[model samples]
Target: MTVGYILGYDPDTLREIVDPEQCAERLDEIGEQRSLPALLERVWLLKVLGRLDEALVLAEQAVRVARMGGTRKDLLRARVLHATILQNRGAFAAAIQELTTCAEEAEGQNWPLLAAFAYQHRGKVSYDAEDFVTARTDFKRALFLRQEGGAPEDQLESTLLAVDAAERRSRSSIAS
Candidate 1:
């Protein structure tokens, strides 16, 4: 799988019911690579496979590696992924706090794509926390950033879907 696929927060993928056997197969295919990118990929895969403990450890290592040697973009990306592991582990406050910092850094750097990625994930974390209003706001920001940055069709579509989902949920919550 591509790095984008591994690192991205794809609602479609999350919505699907993963098979344990297939997860095991995918884990085996990943084997024992030790590169920074490989660690990040492993973090993503482990998170997807419901191995949050392992994912968190790898995610921390990835962040440390990126901070020490990788480029600014790499460090931001690693931090975003690390925050996602926190989100998956139900650390909503911590995840939101980190993502907010990541988003601000990306915006200050004028990296629209990175900003969009951070906002998009922050939106997901907010959604999981049942903060639909905040989720909608963050998703809309992500959509605008993606559009301005000319993100890929899939990324744009994903943001669009997230916005729609958040809007619907927000409305339902208000009606209740």
Candidate 2:
């Protein structure tokens, strides 16, 4: 939320769409760097670049490494990224399952921001699957969690947009 640098890049600007050339440049810069942050950044880059298979492989590795050497939060973050790659790959059920667990764990740990992220991504997966009602519910929860967690304005606005989209879809589906 602080718009910090990851591998010399601001992740917020590149979240949804990464410039392929920039991504390639970063990958080149990250050459032979197998650190956790480097691996995670690589996973994000590969994912946005439509290299889902490679992303998944790296994501799984990130999870393993986090489990072995990182904090609990690190493991959860790695799992979330892994689940996101699954969501991107059309594995809706698996993604939802993983996100559900991640959300619960984050909530149990009183990590509202992380829970919001899980819920938001889960809602996106539901929306992609045409489960508009579930999407709306999840998005609303994410919005609430974001607000409660005092997230950045842009993050709250993003969740609001998602909630609005899901609500519209839900209404249209009901009308049909």
Candidate 3:
């Protein structure tokens, strides 16, 4: 949730919409820079809607905007979102590379939350690619970081993901 941005519209209202396109369209119409958060949200929906090309476009724009005037942590979060789009697109190698860079940068800058988020995303990509061992390690580190940072909400989410990764690792181990 370190997305470093916010939407103009209410969250529950948007989630209630059956079609992501409608939400994305409404967000796009805002046309203001403050709408960057909305744009990023649309990018996520576009990915879920299988509009890969548009998702990439918006994700790139997000990164650019973040770099232009955002804080260091903002840039880090934006890069994480960009890597997330790549991850969803099945570009696991590229996603891993991007997340690794983000993780290193965040850690160096003393932004443990962002670093943990990057690790979590990389864990997801590795899990999707069936690299269970790496996934487990990544998730374990992510959970530890989240807990150490005392972000209860983030720790909860990461904990669930870590549990899933752990199960996958167990099954993979049995199979191997």
Candidate 4:
């Protein structure tokens, strides 16, 4: 669990790079001998490979380990990742609830980056449910937080898309 190597991989890199099964299996083996961060990485790799159920189990273990270790940051990350898995599985409402809790926790901890991520995820959940107004509000909040946190330009594109979608929904509502 080298922090530098872990932090070096941006979201685009994570989304683009597909590890071979042999690599993932090796990671899993190494993870079995390590701490929460290694386990979390194994779960994340599995999730990227579309093994949602397996990732969910590993995520649960991560949450449990984080809790036992009294590592709030790790717990929060595990919760968010698990919520993302749930969202991918079509459990929108549950994902929203988890993200909402995560957002509140981030706010309490003064972690604007985490709050922005949680709000962004919450907005996606709202968009999936066709609640454009709520989605727009969440997106706006996420955008503001991201800007304050100095997030990358590509990250800002999600806010742009959310705003565009919300405006389209608003126009259609007006026309109808």
Candidate 5:
């Protein structure tokens, strides 16, 4: 699990060297061992590598395992990752729904960072759906939480970009 976390967090470097298939295989092995954290990390890595289909499959499997193990946290994480995979596959509405669930769950747990991430993704989904107002609201919430959490500069930049994009879309709509 530690190894998976290390690898997943360094996806930029890992993606440059690790094969998707190898990562997927490792995820399968980790899943077989019922290592929830490892499974989550692998799903994240797979998503970063653009292996959405594989990630979705693994995410579903992780959810099933979480359910059977009665691990609510793992279930939530798996659902969130599943939503990410769906988003990558262009299933925006489904992704939004999943992210909504994640946001609610994270909020319940007082996990600000998780809630922020869910909101950020939900905002992106709304943007894709051409709902600029909602996107802007969600992005603002995400940006606020991220800033409050002292996220890295790069993360703040990305959140700012989402906010800017949403604002631009809203302005364009007003002009039209």
Candidate 6:
């Protein structure tokens, strides 16, 4: 699980995980030890395997488990995962709603990292909806917040999304 968390955040590292199938099997074996994190790993692995339905279920479970005595921060992550699953399923409104909740919570708690993550995901949702203007705003906010408290990868990813949003805006303007 330790290794999984370390590798899971970076797609490059996540892709390099030796034998994902074997890793999944091993995770299941020891999952009973620490259920929440284990469940989250399963969620991510299933998502990586393109099993969105299964990942969604596991993400819901993770959120439920988090609600049971988990910290607010933990619940935030679980909600974020849930929001991500919803987004993948094409439920953009619900996903955005969840992300909005995450953003509010993060802002209330003054957690810049979580706020940036929420904004980034919101930007993704907006981008998916082709609301490039809104996406650009969200991505810009995410980039700024990440610059303050997040990893460089966060800023880079948000910047990429921002670029996409800019291109989209330019294309739309051209069509006008």
Give the candidate number with the greatest TM-score: 1
- Give the whole-model CA lDDT for all candidates, comma-separated: 0.85, 0.83, 0.71, 0.74, 0.74, 0.73
Residue-level lDDT of model 3, residues 34-133, one tens digit each, is 4557666666666656678877988899888878877888778778888888987889999999999999998898877788889988877887786777
- Candidate 1 residue-wise lDDT, 30-140, digit = tens: 788877777877787788788899999999999999988899999999999999999988999999999999999999999999999999999999999988899989989
Q: How well does model 2 score by local distance difference test?
A: 0.83
Residue 85 of candidate 6: its Cα lDDT? 80
Off by over 4 Å in 5: 1-34, 68-71
TM match of model 5 to true structure: 0.71
Pairs that clash in candidate 6:
none
CA displacement after TM-score superposition, residue 55 of candidate 3 (Å): 0.8
Q: Which regions in candidate 3 have their CA more than 4 angstroms from the true location?
A: 1-35
Residue-by-residue lDDT tens digits, candidate 2, 1-176: 11232232232221363367877778778876788898888888788788999999999999999999999898988998999899889999999999999999999999999999899889888988889899889989999999999998878877777777778777888899
On TM-score, the stronger of 1 and 6 is 1
Off by over 4 Å in 2: 1-15
Worst 10 residues of 6 by lDDT: 7-16
Clashing pairs in 4: none
Worst 10 residues of 5 by lDDT: 7-16
Q: Locate the minimum summed-lDDT window of 10 residues in model 4.
A: 4-13
Better of 2 and 4 by lDDT: 2
Candidate numbers sorted by TM-score from highest down: 1, 2, 3, 6, 4, 5
lDDT for each residue of candidate 6 in 1-176, tens digit (9 for 90 to 100): 33433332332111223456765676577565447777777776666556789789889889999999689998998898788788778899999999999988998899988888798888777776767677778877777777788566735663664656556674786699
Off by over 4 Å in 1: 1-23
- Could you tell me every candidate's TM-score relative to the true structure? 0.89, 0.88, 0.76, 0.74, 0.71, 0.76
